[model samples]
Target chain A: MKFKTLVRPLLVATAAVGATAVAQPAAKPSPEGVATAAQNVIIDRALLTAFKALPSRFEDAKNPITAEKVELGRMLYFDTRLSKNQDLSCNSCHDLNTFGVDNKPTSTGHKKQLGGRNSPTVYNAGGHTTQFWDGRAANLEEQAKGPILNPVEMAMPSADHVVATIKSIPGYVTAFQKSFPGEADPVTYDNLAKAIGAFERQLVTPSRFDKFLGGDDKALTQVEKAGLKTFLDQGCQTCHYGPALGGSLQKLGLVVPYQAKDQGRFDLTKKESDRMVFRVPTLRNVAKTGPWFHDGSITELQTAVKLMAQHQLGKQLTDTDAKQILAFLDSLTGELPKGYIAKPKLPPSGPKTPKPDPT
Target chain B: MKFKTLVRPLLVATAAVGATAVAQPAAKPSPEGVATAAQNVIIDRALLTAFKALPSRFEDAKNPITAEKVELGRMLYFDTRLSKNQDLSCNSCHDLNTFGVDNKPTSTGHKKQLGGRNSPTVYNAGGHTTQFWDGRAANLEEQAKGPILNPVEMAMPSADHVVATIKSIPGYVTAFQKSFPGEADPVTYDNLAKAIGAFERQLVTPSRFDKFLGGDDKALTQVEKAGLKTFLDQGCQTCHYGPALGGSLQKLGLVVPYQAKDQGRFDLTKKESDRMVFRVPTLRNVAKTGPWFHDGSITELQTAVKLMAQHQLGKQLTDTDAKQILAFLDSLTGELPKGYIAKPKLPPSGPKTPKPDPT
Candidate 1:
């Protein structure tokens, strides 16, 4: 199906060359990153129509969200006792307080070992088509089980150990019973993932960009609107679209080659098509997240913008254009849910709980 | 559809890591590129079940290949009247005498202009899923119409001009009538393409590998079999499978980043996922098709094999391994269909036929 529209009747190659000619040169933004009165540029609202406002919750029929499950999941998310060393939790890397990331190039895990890829932010991740840099996981529930047992991550040893840890905590047992009522036995590993996934489902953050999409044009500044127009004109929306601005998997470099040690999805799939293919991270609160790309090699937002244009869009963006795009990206910063993400009191470990295994 | 299998249940990433660890090291072949008695390596024929022997003719229901069409197409394929300057034809670049390639990194076209990408061989091309390095053309019929009108290639002004030229040649009219039979108007541009496509359909060359695949174990040397086994074990079969050893679109670099100016399919599609994606060239007559890859930057077959291992397979192939793979590739060199592809006499241009325009 991907090859369907490409098989044109005639003159497709010529038309493609025309497109390359038109889009190769990025439009120069006015000084101060604002549209000049002389310029008189009016960006069509339809260009922004590709994007949708963030939902209140990313609901899944398989794992329905409940107040009890959300609360228990929040506790489990922050519980360090789930790890082999009883030091690292999901929060140790994806800290919800800091917009769901520890801001490390690669997250430190068991024995202070680093992961191969940069730790992607968890905020707005439930809305993604798939999870992880390599897209190794399908959804939040499926992704929740990986790092807990990874040798370089939480290093919990086994699913049985994780289940036993939860069961040994009397408070968690009661919480699980309430969360999964009518089930003869609770506190199972699968149910535990479901609970954490339920909490993650509500991790949406709405921003001024969403307000603009909701017909509140005045929510964004004039410069930001100019930047938005630039974003659309440069064809950045081809990959970075949808509710989260980006969630689908796309190649790292589109126009110019990008040198990266990590082969992304190819490392997992071994399929030639999957090489350098990575899930496009959401732009929501992008300004708050630092060290961009799969390797987190880029530190400056302007540099990231410049590289994206050069490598992905085949455009040599002017400094003003990069800054304007950065201004537009800055508008994506949203207010985090304070009370919803607040760390809950973890259940005390029972006498039967296994001690932290340093080995 | 692409995302289906990727949404795994559990332990997918861990298992993927295991695969990476195991396959990262490419096996070194024997010093003499032959299987040693001590090595005791027996290549199972079943491992090559993915590949099928080359068909006699790549048939298409749309354009049935007949003797009349084949003869007419042979003339049209070699006729220089198809170009604006009357100096170039399909054979100008895809020379039939040289395994259907000019051996240039990129072909010199209209007014000595060079095309952006390498000109792939025409042999076994009819069996490809799609045509062109970017796969813009669906089949040989569609692909036949491209270069003639491309400004840098044959550079015919328009389809109408092409039709008028064919109509002017009295001998071509008779040939077209014979080729088309019941058609009221036989000398059209579409029919011209169909005629050329019909000629190209029978371009398949049967190699010794086909004999080996047909259960003739002695058809291949022991060294070739060792190379074939190495090819299978190195996971070259992932993309380079099927009858032609390859015919699908795959990322140019699956394990390591390959720096290339040409963005491949992305230059046309402008989709982020299409970046660095190119149609995998068939290995049917691979040893004969020199100056490899989309850009044709690589010259030696050994270097190309080594790079494929490093970039696509994440393997550091030993010298012996590269040589062994080359030996296997040599077995793919099939005998050319000399009588079938023999150039036919083209009809003389009529007085009313348009003159070659240099400007």
Candidate 2:
């Protein structure tokens, strides 16, 4: 049956569990003639089969994550020296402490210049199909290489210069040999990206939503579950389904066109059909990493929810529906891996290391 | 992006991998004038984010799987005495060796009477959102109880009679007590179902598709991968997705009305909208568990694929496309848990145990 037809039958309107503390939205008199506690909505748990719990980490056999490699990558991720003036590291924009985002509309980069697109949170990014709003990079390894060379970003002149910087750091040289055992030349730019990618790959966060998906119905409040129902019923899941909630690239203005200067993927592909196509951003940690959308034009989560429904699904969401959906999205805020993301002490720069160039 | 529009660009037409020695449909000569090796087709790995690797087991915290309970369930699964005639067991229909199916269109039960519908495979059943074709049972535990008392099935007179039969057997009494510790009387129907459910919970089969999903590009043959692309491109994954490939209840004959005598879930709900609704069967081990469909009427895999496409998707699949999809379906054939499913030696029946009732 179509989702709309089964909606009333599938949902069992019952008193919510563990929601007594919550203010009652619609309280009624009990059989005993006393005001009842807050009511909780219950949807058929079976509908949740559309989602899966986040895996411990997204594993890739090609880049086998080892202790040596992850440690080396962790150091490289924090070392700002990889940049031209030794000022910007991967962590500078994708800050580990701040849920892998700097919480900026567009990230500040080389020489305090701003990037064109919003920097997405690196958390759970390994599970994404592709990286960036335009999806130019295929995997984490390929994505790690882009920002380092971009003029407005890290501003490293070339791969050789980046490799030389790492080679000059005596500690990184030893770390590289250990990380990539038996390699003829280990301190290459490729290995640097690989090491960084390996670390980023393990950056996963487990949230309350995962607990709910893992068969714990009590993990989410009744309101949150209702909000989830609203989100699903609204067809947000058309583009936002899966462990990461959203990873597939989709047409931004699918039903109703939005006013936008950026052509999105069309700027890269130069194909008319590619116009306004962007990778659907993951809803994981979405509550934390806001200043929303490709251009970070909408700061309020409520506005983003309403516009998405309007432009993508051709549905108008009431303020009440948007609020409920926000409550559901708030449950997606995950606990970060504290020890795993801790900033490590970088190795000392060698005497022969290139001096910082302000140019 | 629409899947159809992205298809040609997302897929890179190439030679099939590891397909040598097999007859090639259209083999071309190399520039060196030598016949080329088997060709492999490659699709964008990004599209595969739709699928997830199956977990080792679908864990339910409510009914935890323990060694004692599983062992008890193993014996119960094979014990024919549970049936009124002492001629059948759970394994009589869901044969473990044959991918949890009897290979019959529908199973014969009490007095050799055939059931109304095909007996679906029990493998990976715990991952399903709901149990049975009509989704009458909510979980494996609930599903375990239905056939035991059904007049056409095991045909035990009542739940009390079933409990009394178990209580009479000294081994079962002791086993139940051990499985459900601290209970004053443990040899009850509810505990019996829980034990069986616990055993069934771990009945997972890991397949090559899982390996492919876990970032191993070469896990599937080139033909299999292409077949997967064809499957995805056709939008089969809309109903057949997640770790189990399918578990959701969907409307059968979505685009085209099927010629059917059965009302499916409509019989249970008595609602007009539920006329042709049925729980979408899991595709895991589906290649082995056929004679397919609710009535098992369609015997050939090719014919079933064609009918499903025509009726549900409203698309006519060419013979080549159907054959390619079959290759992909073959990849879903998972390795059965041989050691786990091995029938245990049933305990001796006690003196007061009721005799098999033929009438």
- Enumerate the candidates' DockQ scores in order: 0.01, 0.08
> Model 1 chain B: which ten-residue window has the lowest total lDDT?
B5-14
Q: Positional deviation of A1 in candidate 1, in angstroms?
A: 33
**Sliding window of 10 residues with minimal summed lDDT for model 2 chain B:** B8-17
Per-residue CA lDDT of model 1 for B1-359, tens digit only, reads 01211122211111222222222223323465445511434455534544779999899999999999988888999999999999998988998889999898899998999997788999989877778998888789999999999999999999999999999999999999999999999889899999999999989989999999999988888878778866765557655766787766665653333556787777887654456667889998888888888887777888888777655544556778777788899999998999866667778889999998887
Candidate 2 local lDDT, B1-359, one digit each (tens): 11222122111111111232121121222122111111456655545655668998888988988999999988888888889998888889998989999999899999999999999888899887788888888899999998888889899999999999998899999999999999998888999999999988888999999999988889888778767856765556656766888776665654334546676766776644345667888889888989988888878887788767654444456666777778899999999988877789888999999999987
lDDT for predicted candidate 2 compared with the true structure: 0.76
What TM-score does candidate 2 get on C-alpha atoms?
0.64
Instruction: For residues A187-253, write the lDDT of model 2, one tens digit per residue.
Output: 9988998999999888989999999888888888876876786676555665676678877666575
Most TM-score-accurate candidate: 2
How many clashes in candidate 1?
A: 0
